[model samples]
Each structure stands twice: as C-alpha cells, then as structure tokens.
Target: MKKIIICLAFSMLTWHSFAQDIPVKITKSELFKDEYKNSNIVLVEDDGSGGVVIVRSYAGGIFSSGYGYYFEHYDSNLKLLKEYEYQSKVKKEDKKIYRSILGVIMNGKEINMIEYIYDKKLQSVTFNALTSNINDFDFTSKELFNMNSKDAESGNSGKDRDAGAQMIINEDKTAFAITVDIKDKNSETHKIYLFDKALNQKIDHTFKRDIKDRKFIYENIDVSKDGNTLYLLGKVKTDEAKKKKDGGRYQYELTRITSTDEKTQVFDTDEHYAASLKTIIFQDRLTCIGFYSDRNDSRFKGISYFELDPNSLAIKKSKFNPFTEQFMIDKYGKDKDKELKNLRFKQLIITPQNEIILNAEEYYEVYTHVMTQNGGGYDRWTYHYDDIVSAKINSDGAIVWARNINKRQDTSVYGNPFFSYTSTAKGADAYFFINTGEKVRKIRKDRIEFKEASPKRSNLTVIRINENGDFDYREVLDDEENEVPFMVAYGELTGDSVFFLGQKGKKKQLLKLTL
Candidate 1:
C-alpha cells in the first residue's frame, strides 16, 4: 500500500513525502493553542540541534499602544521550553507606549532579541521618537547590550534608529546588524553594525547615496552562513523627467549592496522599484530574484534574476524570460494590444535546482461614468479585461510550459490573475488560498489535476509541494464548523497518516493522522 505521512512540529506542520499518490485525502489536527493569532510567526531551527523556536508578539496594554513581542522555544514533540518578553517606551512625556519587535537571531549558545519603541511627543509625520534595544539571553542569564542610563540622555546615534533591523551570525559566533534609517533626509542612508556574540559593538558602517528626489528603500539583508560576507538589497528612487502637480516623480533605480574586503560594492539598475526581493546564496553562486512592475503602466511587470560573482559582486542578468517563446505567445496571443504584451510579473519562485518560475497577471484599464443632469439618462460605462497567466522556465530562462489560468470574466475583477506557483521536487503546481475560500489545484507529471477542498471553506488554504517538484498534498481546516479531517500533511507514499495544523473557533490546533 502507498502511504504518505506528515509531521507537525508546532502550530505549523512542515510536510515531507517519500512516495507518490493520486487523489489523496488530507486530514486535520489540533496541535496546540493559537497564541499567535494576530502576530506574524518566524520559525527557526534550534541551534543546529533538533526542535523549533517561535518569535511572536502580543497586543499592547492600551489602544494604539503597539505590540509586546515575545519568543518561545519548543522541542520536536511540541513541548514548550522557555518564553521571554520585552517592552519599550517611545517618549519621556507620552504615557502611551507603542512598541514593536523587529527581528530575532539564534547563535550557537545564545538568542539575540531586538525591538523598537515609538513615542508620540518627539514625533513628526515623517519622523518619530524611536529607541532600539538588543538583548542576549541564555537559559539562566540575560545581558542587555548598549543599555546604559547615561547613554539614554546623550541621544546616542543608535537610540533614534529605525526598528526594522536584521541580524546575522558569523562562524566565530559574532553578530552583525543592518537597519534602515527613515529619519535621514536622503532616506537612502543605511546603517550597519557588527557585534560579538555577547552583543558588544564591533564595527559600525554606513552607506549613503546622493541622488536628488530619489529615496532609498531597504528590502532585505543577509550574512553568509560562514559570516564573512554581508548582502544588502534596496531600491533607489529618481525624480521623474516631468513633475506632476501632486509633487511626485516617475523614475527609480533598484539597487543591491554586497560587502567584501571590508568594502561595499553597489549595483544599481534602472528597473522600477518593488516592495520585496528574495536572495539565495550558494557556495559559489549568489542569486537575486525580484518582481518588478512599471508604474507608468500597471500591466507591465516581469521577474529579473541577477547572478553575482561572490568575490567581486558584479551582476550579470542570468535568466531573462526563462519561460518559452511559445508559452508567452499563446498566453498573450499575437493579436493582443502592445500594452498586453508588456504585462508585468506579479509573482516568481526559484527552485533548489536553480530553475526560475515566472507568473504574470494581465492588466486592464477601468473607465468610470459621470451622470449628466441634462441628458435624463445614465452615460455608458466600460472597463478593461486583465488576463491571468502562469509559466515555467528552466535555469537558462527557457520557458518549459505556459498556461492561461483565466480569460476575461465580467462577474469578478479577474481575481488578480496572479496565482502562487512554486517549484516542488515532486513537480510544479498552482495554489490559491484566500480566507474562507481555500483550494489546492494540483497538476501532476501525467497532466492529471486533483483538488482538496478547504474546511470552513474559510478561503484560507495551505498547499505543500515536495522537494521533487510533485504535488505532496494539501490541508484545509476551519473551526466555524467541526468538519475537519484528522491530519493535514499526508506524504505521497511514505505512510498512510497525515499531519496537519488545525484551526477550531478561536484556537489553533495540530494533529497527526493514521489512516
């Protein structure tokens, strides 16, 4: 008998499969409490050991008071190990407190915690009173870094920094932090600081740019697993050729920064800025992937991948339009308007094997009608149609397969046409999970399609594809009604049981399956 087994570590279940199965049924379980209902949860493996660590937040005491974030350690069996919480005050006079937990890092034997507090009194729409604190904690003792009473009044440069910080640990156990400065006039100035594992400061570096009218937006940063190299991702804005009456420009440069030989190298491209970019670094290759959209035309978007030499940090466009020519032609059609040909890529994914998958949602125009009093009749109204498409490309940017997921529909606004496409070792599949309306559509190697319905049909769906690029299975759980399966994660062939993260009413639960 072919069986699939899934395991749930904490409130979340990571699915792994050993074999393949078609038309598999997913079960559900109640693993534990739903403590992180409103807060985002980052899952970290336990210090190269076994187990998991969760860093989360709680609603502050008073309204508009912000959040009180905390960290909890758990074992492989989902047993809680320890929990820690921290709070911050924004200003001296404002009794109200607004706090946020930015990021968390785990070194060999210690856990590093960082947070930010915003005060209303010393605040401006563009700037506010902010304080950042870093703490190092072990099982028995805790040490606060750069936390001196005298240092508070000095307004030391670190006190006013932004709360969005990232931490990376070196091979020697030292830690480094990179944070963006929103208060800087240039908005392109970013701060980088290095620290020992004990949270002691080492070297402080700053990267500043002087492009007029263009602000810098920091996207993400990472340190090499060995800790010798640091990678910074951001975008630079440029003034539009022509200014609008509303006071904003129309051009920008997407930028990347890499540190080597104690010096930083910058790579700037004239691509439109995007909200986020994902970077993956292997032993010899560094890959950067970002989804870009043209502001002048919302429909113009695409995914661009850059391969950089780790030592020199020089970027060469690795794979542009990896998807096949036929795939693109079939989706857009030869007769479509030129603007349709320029549709933007809204979603993209890179597989472990280095293959790039690009998904683009078509764009359309919307027209509104203004009623005329003299005409005694309503004016005609018209709207544009946007197409939804998905395409697969090889490592060299050659299209492997392409399909149009949506045509034009009058009942709905094309539902944003962009579908979530990720590479799985089992194969490739498209996922769509909206709250209360979750559904998993699986396309197998044989071109067979299977779907698992979401419970509560709450539109919230979780889909998992194994490392082999094949559809492992899917889980749909809802508490509004008690009609959930026993487990959620059922591998394709390892075992008959399924593993799942379940939600019942107000509680988040987990369960194991034995079908």
Candidate 2:
C-alpha cells in the first residue's frame, strides 16, 4: 500500500510537467552584416515556398545618397539564400550618391524590388524583378512594370518630389503605385497606377480635389482581402465657416474603390476629428469596425459597424453611435453632475465570433487636498490624469463587460502606455497592458493591480481572456533579476506555434510560445 501511494504521487508530478506550456526557442542569424549597422529589417512574409524575403533599409549611409539598401532572401530555416545589391552608374566628384529600396513583393516564382536612387546628375527610381529560379524568372516578360525617379517626379511639385510616392501589392500579385503631384498653381493631385503581375501597366487613373488652405498629406491605402476593393484613409482641411460652425472641425474621409467604378464612395466624418477603419472577413462575410474622435480628445465618441455586399461594393445596414447609455452609466455611475464626458475610443478589435472589443480613454483635471488635524492649515493642488477604459460588445451592439483601467492617484503616461490584445494559436486571446511612469522620490508610481512590485522602470501585465471577456489566467513578465524593458510589436499564430516580435537589449527579437 505504501509503494502504490508513492507511485501515484510520482505519476501525477510527471503529468503536470508534461502539461506545462513553454516559450519557443529563438536562434539569431546575421543575414546581412557589412558597413551597415543598426539596419531596419522588414520581414515581408514566409512564402510557404520555403523562403522569406527581407528588405534592409540604410536610413543614411556614407556611400549611399538615399535611405534604402537591397533585397536579401533566406531559406525556411533562415539560411541566407541569395542577395541582389543595387549600384548606380552615374559618375560624381562630390560625396557618394545613395539609392534606397522601398518596396518588394513575390510575383509567382520571381521577386520584384523597387528602389529610389538619388545622385548629383540624376534622381530616379529603379524597379527590378529577380527570381531565385533563374530559368523560370524571365527578364523579357512584357507583364513587368518599372518606373524611374523621373517618372515619379513628373507628378510632384517643387516642394519635395520624393514625399508622396507609395506602392501597394494586391493578393493576385498586382501592384498599385500612388503618387501626389503638385500642379502649376501649387494645388495637389493624386495619381494611381495599376500594374499586372508581371509589372506591366494595366490602368492609370488620376484625380484632383480642392481644399481650403489645406495641403494634402498621404496616409495609407490598403487592398481588401477579397482583392477587389481598396480603402484609403487621409485628412483634409475645412473652410473657415465650416470649421467654426463645427467647433474647429476638419474633414476626414474613408474612401472605398472598386474595379468597375470610376468614382470612389467617400465616408466623411465631422471636423476637428480623425477616424480609423478595421475590416475583417470571417466565414465569407465582411465586417468593418470604425472609430472616430476629435483632435484633442482621447475617447472615441463614435463607433460604427457595417456589413458589406462584396459583389456590389455597397454597405448593407450600418449602425453608428456613441457608447450605449446603460454601459456608460453602469461603469461610471448615473450621477448627472459626475458624468464622464468627452471620452474617445482608441482601439477596436473583432473576435472570431464577430464580437467587438473597444478600448477608450478620457482626460480630466482633479484637485488634491491635504488636511492637518493639529493647528495647521490645509493645502490643495490640482493635477490632470487620463482615465483608460475597456469594453466588450457583442455583434448586436450590446456591451458584455466594461471596466476602467486607471487607478486613483496613479500618474498615467500620456501616449506612452502600451496597449495590445492578441489571439494565440490555441484559440485563446491574451491582452497586454504596459504602463511606463516617471519615477520620482524613490517611490514606484504605476503598478498592475493585485500583482507584486513590477519592474520599477517599466510594468507589463498579460491576461488571457475568454471569448466572452472572462479572465482565465494572468502572468506578470517583470522579475527582479530580469529588469530589462521588453515589448511586443507584432504577434501571429503560425500553424500550431505562436510567434511574437519584441525587443530586448535594444535589439529586436522574436519570441515563440508553444502549448
């Protein structure tokens, strides 16, 4: 009986160890190391074809005139496969000219690279398509599109010719090049070109819009998952009367375009405000989440959802509004005098079930008072702090749960707090919040609730939340011995493994977590 009891205990211990999840092991390799230090590595994609293409940028170099370097390829295990370096033939006696590579994409078996070359005699752009399989990579392919700096500059004004040229590659390996050109009268116009998989120009379109005392700044244009729709987000100016009437508001629009249409459908928001739109395709249905806010506001007062008809490029029934009154009143009491107003939503994410998670923040001023019981005078001071809030809403616009992330007397860093929520490969979601506060008088200012002293320099909190917003497990990454500041910029569920892009020792590192 004693031996049997001892054997049972050993079996249980072994089972527990086997069930524990461990972090993924990472091995570092120098893909490119020569004359260039502190290079920016843009990891494009792991083309299940057993290779990954990385574009390294030399912001400024002694021999280079501009900011980009070249394209380097690595095998599935990160072994250096091949490299294509660019060199200009232009001769100059002054300082060395530089050429920078901007965009790259894999077209079938070949790879396409774009570079911006700057020299005393000439400033131009170069496009090249190279393949690892030389026999299959045809240079004589008429489907290839190549544009030089002169062609790109022809659309720009004297201010900064290189400022507006940006490119995007679609799902079918087609490319769209967008450039902003300044007219003779100093007005700006946008030009968009569509190129085929082989880089040949398929269509060219240009349009101009008038603005009152406002210069056009190009932001971002993304091709939708269906490969037919494009979404453009950018800012515009408002006339004086419109600005004053709308509380100093400017106009921002979310424009969507399709191949069959010549005019784009523009969704304009109120002025002095900005908006962000996130679209996801789930189970063959398209869903969009948009957040809008004013310039100085931290809380997003507007939230909207839209279901689109992929074939017609039209929104089916879209609903938009501020947070529901019941949700606001429940978390922040219904006291009319103590109402939390002017809050703005910052982030919006959708779960697998089509539920929406919104995170918002509000800023307010408070007065701090100190009293003395003895024969002493009372003292008072005023300070400002931002209240961070999070809420989970269902597909029907019902709030499932809500909470405020801020604590009393804790000084929150404006624009410095880290916010992220990601889904793991195990179908579980993990939410992370890291707040970096200023250390004063040897006292730790910001700390995660219920957790022990976090890293004095930086604090990190990781919580695993269920699909219904229920907490399952939580982990605090800060330890006494490991005081370094760690951060996660990107995360993905690759196959059965979870990969995370983070930083340690000022060098970017990748973390893999496995179950």
Candidate 3:
C-alpha cells in the first residue's frame, strides 16, 4: 500500500458586497500533497462532534493498484487529524467486470462503505456493505443482497433506465433503503430493503404484482426513523405510452411499505402531467414537490406540490402554480419558443418555517456518430447542463415567486463534474454555488449569466436568492488568490454550512462556507 501524504494550512477569504449583508464566511485550507489528480470527493460527513470526515476516491487501472480511496478526518478548526488509505483489494487478476461505490456513510462509531460489484464469470451482481470501526479502521464485508445479471440485461431496453441496485439515505441519516429491479421478457421482480445506520436489516420483501401491464422505475426511497416503514416515489409507464417518448402517457406513483402491508397512490390528474416528482418527510408529513406540464406535453408549465397521508398515501392537499411572467422572460427573453423541457430535479430544501425552496436544471445529452476508415462507426455523446429554474413555495402550497438562472455548460471539452452546481439554504435565503469564468456577463438589468470557465482560471461564484425571488451573485473566490479549483458539484451540505474539496494536479484542499 502507498503511504498517503497530508499537509494543511488554513486561511479565511473576505466576501464581496451582497454577501457582507449576511456575513458569508469562507475558510479554506492550503493545498496538501496528493499523488493522484484523478480523485473526487464522494462524501463530507460531520462526525457527531464539530469535526468532519472527508472521503475521496482515486482512479486506478490494470497497470497500477486497483481503484482505492482516501479517508481524511478534520477537526472543527479545519486541521487534519488523521488520514486512511483504503487500498483496493481487487487486483487485475481478480477479473471483476464492473464496480462502483454507491455511498460512504459515517455513523456513530462506524464507517459504512456501500458498493456494487458485477462478476462477469459468475454472471452475478452483489451489493456489499463494508464496515469499519472508527477506532480500529479494519473493514469487514457482508453481502446485503445479490441478483442475476442475465435478468437485468434482458430487461433493460433503454439507456436512461438502470436495472441494478439503487440506494437512498434519509436526511437525518438514521436509516437507508435499497431497491433492486429485475425484469425479463415474461415477468419482472422488485426487491426493497430497509436497514438501520448500523447495517441491521429491518425489512426485506419482493414486490412483483404491479409489473404486468406497466413498468415502474423508482427514483427516490426513504425509510422511517425506526427503519420499520419504507416509502418509494417513482414513475410508471403503461402500454399506451409510445417507445422513446415522455409525457402524460406516464404517471408518478408513491408506494408506502410497512411490515404488514403496502399502500400506493398514483399522482395522475386529468388536467396536468407530472414531469418530475421528489418526496420528503417533513414535520411528520409525506410531502412532494416537482414540475408539471400541460396535458400530454413534456414541456413544463409550472410547479406542483402535494401533501399526502404518510400511512395511507392519500392526497390531502395539492396545488399547481404556473410559472410567473418574470420567470419566462428571465429564461427565454423574447424568443418565440418558450417551451421548457428536460428539467431534472436537483434540490428540494424545506426550511424551518415550513417553506419549500425547489430547484431544477436543464440537462440532456446528444449523441453523434464518428466514422472510421474501415467503414465502421462509433458513438460519441455530449452532456449539456444548462439553465437553472428555482422557485419558492409557501406553507399553504402556493408558489411565492419563480426565477431562472442563465448559464450554459457542456462536456465536449471539460468534464461533467465541473458543470452542474450545488445548493444549500439558510433561513429564508437560498444559496447556489457554481464555477464560472473570470467575468459574469450582465445581459439584462437584473439578469446575469455564467459562461464555461477553464479549470485553472475558474471563479467560485455564489448566487443568493432571497425569499422574494430576487437574486444577486458575486465571486467568493477568484483564480488569482486560489491555486486549487473547487469542484462545486461535489459539495456536502450540513445545516447552514457546506464543505467542498478543491484539487488541482497533485495538490488538494478543503473549503468550508458558512452561510
């Protein structure tokens, strides 16, 4: 195993005008020594104390050690306490076809590493939980579940749909849930599991009744604090829907699973279609917020909110608010084609006051064919992360205001990790952190745009939107003052503070923003 290096120095950055009104404190650690630049922060968790635990994974190939990880622990004062190198056990001789780390969890006195591995020779896929004590740091692996790869490959027909395992952890981190879907030509099967923070399995059941007429894809899952109940939110597709199409032909469904029975609610109305939906248990109530579109059309028209009975999955209150005029102008200016499509849900924050701050981004992919000299061709894909639409919903389920942030980013040159942004909320104000070029262009009186910036000369910018939907942005960290570039998309938000890891070449640093 390679001995990991660590060096840390702390400094505070001064904020600009608007941030001064509410005091945005920036604490940064100087660049530390690292051997691999192909690393990204996967988790930044607060250890019950004021300290934090940061975990990053470094890439490895057949020539080098297999994929490995670095676990760094820091005190509340931003000083490094300890670092651990989890050398990958999978060598080239292992012949593992595919592997991915789902998430890294830090519980009371333990660290849980949840991962998925596919074995080509055995034709099996396994979900394993690697557990280590905080004091001992020695890991033990346990297989939580397994599936046959043949069933997954034969059932999956599209690129967007994933037939493997999916994991979700609740906001409080008390429990987590995992769902796996296996489908074949004749039948389909679904498995849902709930586990406590200590990796104790609470509920394990197979769901297969709802797959005869339609296919269901679950996007969100949450387990109760006690790990006794499970909730799932996803989209359902019926035979009426055409191939390679999206819109009203599909409907959103909420399933509540308990130890005894399961209840479901389909959120399909005659007037509008739910383009996207995300759910959270706030104040002991099952609440959902998402975007809606006019009948059958995939283009979004407004925001949608619903309050449902937690146990029965019954809708108690519902509201659909159209986009405001100012929001349309902010997004489209004077263009005749004002349709908003391909908006994926990014963040949904419920404040202490019971208000909701919702955000989504315009994202899509374009694939092109490149020909070779032998009359054969290969497919190349480009990912686009574009404009962001943000809105605020009052406690009564009415949209207070909606706004759009203009930006354009693609993965043709730079990677997708540097394109999208991260968000956190403080009181009534919502903050979005992104990386932009040297200058942000102000095209309109109140609108500004963020263009693609190079990694070396990027500006870590923060856009703050008040409760009234009025927003202002400024550079929190400029390129000249900072040597390491911040990966805004990889930030971890805990309460009012968010932590980001900045890395450039063989140097990396930790950045903390107190909003």
TM-score leader: 3
User: Which digits, one per residue and each the tens of the lDDT, describe model 1 over residues 1-515?
Assistant: 10113335334344433333333333333234533333324424343455455554456444444355555554545555565554344455556434454445555555555544434454411111112222343233232322212212212354332333445544233455544443344335555655544555555556566743134544556666445456666554444423433312332223333342343444432444333455655567666664444443233344545667666666655543433343344444432322234354554555555565555544444455666779655534333323445555455545455554433322123331112221122234433221222332334322323222333333223334333333333333343433322222111111233323434444443333222
- Clash number by candidate, in order: 48, 23, 0
- Residue 305's C-alpha lDDT in candidate 2? 59
Clashing pairs in 3: none
lDDT of 3 by residue, 1-515 (tens): 32335544445756545544546788876567665556778777787788878788888755665677888777776777777888666667776567777777777878999888888888988889998876567889999887887755422445235466778787778888777766644444567888888888888877654454235665677776556788777777756553424346666778888867887898764467776678877646788888888744568888888989887788898888888887888986743335688898788887878788898898888989999999999988888888988898987889888988999877764455666899888888888999898777777655678897876568888888898888888778788878788888778887678888887767677789887
* Cα misplacement distance, residue 271 of candidate 1 (Å): 9.8
Ranking by lDDT: 3, 2, 1
Candidate 3 stretches with Cα past 4 Å from truth are: 1-8, 13-22, 96-100, 117-126, 143-160, 212-214, 239-247, 295-297, 334-337, 366-382, 413-415
lDDT of each: 0.42, 0.44, 0.76
- Candidate 2 lands at a TM-score of 0.60
Kindly give the stretch of ten consecutive residues in candidate 2 with the minimal lDDT sum.
1-10
Tell me the lDDT of model 1 at 230. Answer: 66
Q: What is the TM-score of candidate 1? A: 0.57
